[model samples]
Target chain A: MAPKYKLTYFPIMGLAEPIRFILSYGKIEFEDNRFESDKWPSIKESMPFGQVPVLEIDGKKICQTIAICRYLAKQVGLAGDNDWENLQIDMAADTVTDIRTKIVSPNYETDEEKKQKKKAEVINETLPFLLPRLDNLVKQNGGYLANGKLSWADLYFVALIDLLKFMIGFDITKDYSNLSALKNKVLEIPAIKEWVAKRPKTER
Target chain B: MAPKYKLTYFPIMGLAEPIRFILSYGKIEFEDNRFESDKWPSIKESMPFGQVPVLEIDGKKICQTIAICRYLAKQVGLAGDNDWENLQIDMAADTVTDIRTKIVSPNYETDEEKKQKKKAEVINETLPFLLPRLDNLVKQNGGYLANGKLSWADLYFVALIDLLKFMIGFDITKDYSNLSALKNKVLEIPAIKEWVAKRPKTER
Candidate 1:
């Protein structure tokens, strides 16, 4: 019997959107289960680690967004075939996730002064740190993160750049031409383009 | 020729210890490179993401501790044989990692205050969320994280529990008896036991 897959996450796109995008791009069928804020307490109790974005495979629960994404990516043959390429893809995706978790996840003060301070740190410290590295890697690896082919890491990078623009109101790829080119390249993929165009509109 | 591996990080365990532990337990030889504060600037520039704990394999650099550990784990067959089990192990390990990253990674005012806050949050949020779920999984699976066999996730839990105790200066597992037993059982693995005894002491 085919395993039944269902994803549980908040309505926001913060962590769950990438997984949704991956499944959509792969043309895999799954349920996108969103929970209301008020309904989270009781629902949260049943989750491992009390976290959402858990993927239920045939009624068995699996937690961690990256792990679930990678699992599905492997099933869809989006993860690179060889060990070396897979490692590179994992590294790129995980690096982006780490930066997002640290600088982009926290919502601090609403005051302009504090927001600007946080934005400045992101632009100066994190953006500068990540963009050039990714640019160089793309240049070195012939424009793809792994296998010089469209891997999940490429989609992850596109999602990350999109989120950065949304959160900070800044264009990271504008300065990094290579990354801009890479993003355009990824969007050119038929499945990904379709997924993006038809993706559910949710506030991140 | 066997590819040479070099790891660069600060002296503290923070993110580097897991990679170190996995390599040591797997009996894979690698250069353990530590950097002093003064040397960080030069070393940091060389890192792909300006972060420590980058792994150099065959002179090629890879960033992200989780990615590196996953790569190493796969090489030593520590991840798991099948895709499903591998996903489960990765998910569990990453879930624990998320909690640590959120609650314990901050530079709190002092050890006392940090411990107090961590203890409260662990009891309230983390313990209730993770302990029973993991315990149930272990009980059902016959003690290991996946496929009824030891995996890197099993070892990761051991490291995580030890870190919690080290950080809070209290026995956390006392409350979760199954977790306490799981930790003890993980420690009994011969390779892990030897590695634990010889593991370099660090302020994790």
Candidate 2:
């Protein structure tokens, strides 16, 4: 029997979207269990670590978005063949995570002054330093994020691009042709395209 | 033939200690390549993503601290037997990583005023909220983290405690008996004790 999957998170494509993309890509059915902010406090206690994006697989609940994504990727044939290859894929995914955190920090910054300063820095300094290296990596790897193939890291990057653009209020990858094309390629996938077109619309 | 192993990082135990612990536990010999701060500029470009704590196996450089640690953990029999177990281990390790970043950020903050504020918050609000949960987890798991037996997350947490204490200016685990016990247990391992006794001493 196929193990049932239930993903719990906010409706936004902030972090859980990567898991969703992998599931959709694999044509695996899962309960996309999203909730609102007001319900979070009540929902918090049942969680393993009082965090969201908890994935319920079989009868057990697992925490952490990356952990969930990696597990699902392996099931869907997106993971590498061996340890060394997986190391490269993990490195690329982690690099994307690093960039994502920096880009999105401004959105979560409570202080208005710091938010403005961080936004500027992310746009002027952070993006320039990071995006070019990522662009180069994509180019070198022949249009994929890591391991010179369409691994889970590529899907993770594509899922992240939408959230990144929403948070930063700009399509930062417009200048990076390789990244833009890569995003397009992933979006054009039949299942992912269908999932995107039919997915619920959210404010963030 | 055994693959040649080399670790590139500063002489500190900051993030590389977990990998060191795993390698030592597995009796895998590795070149502990340490570089001084003054030589970092020239060496920076050679590193993947301009970061330290890279582990090279037979001349192939692998980046990211957690990724490197996970790869090494699998080699040393510290990783999980199955995907579900690995997910739990990854969650535990990531939770520790989150707490570590919060605790260590003040040390890296350039502004004195902000650093002091962040330091106070980390010691007060952050530790108070997080430590008890982690302590209970250690207690529940019987001195190991993530699983019922010893896993790499346990080693990772133990390695992180020393640096956390160093950065925060006090021993944060004194009040958490389970965490303290877990730390003692890891430190008492023969290979780890031997590695700690002779490893390069650094200010951080």
Q: Which pairs clash in model 2?
A: none
Candidate 1 structure quality by residue, lDDT tens digits, B5-29: 9988887666777787788778889
As a TM-score, model 1 comes out at 0.89
Residue pairs in collision within model 1: none
Model 1, which residues run further than 4 Å from truth? A108-116, B105-124
Strongest candidate by DockQ? 1
How badly does each model clash, as a count of residue pairs?
A: 0, 0
